[model samples]
Target: MAVMTSRFADGLAVGTNLVDTAEAAIRQALAGLSGPPDLVCFFICGDDPDDVGRAGQRAMAMVPGAHVIGCSATGVIGAGQGVELQPAVSAWAASLGDTKITTFALETLRADDRFVVVGLPERGSDDQVAILLADPYSFPTDAFIEHSSEALGSLPIIGGLANGLQGRGSVRLFADGEVHEEGAIGVVLGGPVSIGTVVSQGCRPIGPSMVVTRAEDNLLLELAGQPALARLEDIVSALDEDDRELVASGLQIGVAMDEYAERHERGDFLIRGVLGIDPEREAVAIGDVLEVGRTVRFQVRDAETADEDLYELLDAHVERTGRVDGALLFSCNGRGSAMFGSADHDALAVRDTLGPIGVAGFFAAGEVGPVGGHNHVHGFTASILVFSSQAAPAAGA
Candidate 1:
């Protein structure tokens, strides 16, 4: 059995006044803990940039001694519920005891024809974890994450793309009380803390896997020596009417992460969106780059499948870890009511299965988490960073 303590807590406030809502949420989160937390994370959703900035500052002031990092979001989740496309504030805090936390900011620059991500620190150790929040429009999150395997080694990087209602479409990133209009913000945690991750690409495979015979950087030209569009047409023709309707709405492609695996299962493939098709050239465009010889499968998603997928993954994590004390959930903005046609589906699932653990998160434009031991920017997915039983017990436990 796992012991529970007040080491971690979360709060959620919903209203039109952003600053007051932020303070209320922070107060609620701070109430359970004995003293100031070691780390504080917040997510705010609102239309006014000025209000969002002020609210972020107030939230930081409430926890003056802790390292703070967060960003504006389309929706905020906490207190066992999710607030979608509304004005809300969510706060999460942790008393990590002696854990070491370091905050950072990153920006991108273009050198000739290449895009370079600057401001990444050297990996501290083999056991550290990184939580990052980036502006989708300004930061090269995909490129930065693709190279993290080499740059940070085995250190797991988790978090997501911040979405804001700013007039210019740029997002706000918060680090240590200051709000940044561009780049990314994050914290690297080492020492007595451990974070376990679960990335649920809530889709089910629809047909047999096919080998990519020809591709051009996100465009699948041929599969098994046949035009990609032709293969897709055949697959769609064979599916039942309901399944075909799903494909017509939002089709997905799963790229096998390991080619040598004898069989690809649910967790074996990196799911990407099927952007569009080129009927003239008989090609299918996907969200990510595809190399020839990779196995690909057609996938479909719906509210029922998504709900089942998230709960199943959460159950597996609890089975392995024994308990989940707290968690940070980064779900894609495409989720929530947009996908599920209901509020709090993902957030409630976590609380219901994990047994009332503190959890907070936001509906990110794109979620970041490891798929097949590698980090990738994903869409229509839920990526959760779980602080397990390994967290140091509350101050005097």
Candidate 2:
């Protein structure tokens, strides 16, 4: 008798040999599944491009009929642990009953002063989610995400930028069964399976939200009839000593995505860095462009704040949508031991709160996920894609 069921599993292995590590990880994941998976994704963390490519090829060969995709990272997360600065491989496999998977590779073309993304496939009506892995040095991820609505409609994207110690020319992306030196690779999944998204920017707002009275491009000229920098200074002066210390080290600006919302909270704003202040103009520069009438607030981040932010979101996910069948986590490379002073902080949180289920991912250069119904590339964030279990008719009933 034939059966139809959705299943997921993840595994991890660490060693000097990339191929051996990848094979062990894939085998560990495969052992947890009932049958062959429909899709397989692996993350390899190593410095050598040649070795990474070989390991990717071997992973593809191990799962011949399944769609394979992955990229090289500086660290990997799986098996309820995160391994950093080591040669490690993390593999995730899913047998999604009756789901359709389409994979494509995208490249960038320089036309005059602008770069255009080429090879974006037409999106289908049933397409629900897209998993994207791109090279930060070669791909214009920010621009692509900004225009994603025009190209792919409302489909949510969840993935991250591949990272390495040897920046720029060292990125390697894997799709189908091939390794790409430059460009981006992704897979679109459509079917009965349910996918949920979670994006935690790991920042907490510290001041009252104010509307922008004047602005020029990315420069904030005025806020609520006062100089932007001056307003910021006032806010900092009122904060307690700890918060003031946080602001002194580094500060961020959170731009409200929805202007009409009565209240602005943690997840409601898109956070940007407070780049530099122009004392002469009394203006503040941000990482993104801001328009007049937009609401903005000051934000601060630290180890304790980041931990609280992620765990709160994860708990909310469980309460609202039951337990997830599996999850793919894309955490900022700046996190892990650097932020928490301990290893496997994010990975353990996801597994302890929501898991014992399948979960795998890597520490990304930049995380990608939607905030307030819009996709954007973020830093110091943890972007996650959670899959719900699904069932369908037997294949040969």
Output the number of the lDDT-best candidate.
2
User: How well does candidate 1 score on lDDT at residue 332?
Assistant: 87
**Candidate 2 residue pairs in clash (backbone atoms < 3 Å):** none
* Residue-by-residue lDDT tens digits, candidate 2, 98-148: 888998999998899988889777888878889999999888898899899
Compare the candidates by TM-score and give the number of the best one. Answer: 2
C-alpha-based local distance difference test score of model 1: 0.85
Residue by residue across 129-170, what tens digits does model 1's lDDT show?
789999888888888888888788767788999988763554
The 10 consecutive residues of candidate 2 with the worst lDDT sum are 388-397
> How far is 40's C-alpha from truth in model 1 (Å)?
0.5
Shift in Å, residue 180, candidate 1: 0.3
Q: Let me know the TM-score candidate 1 reaches against the reference structure.
A: 0.94
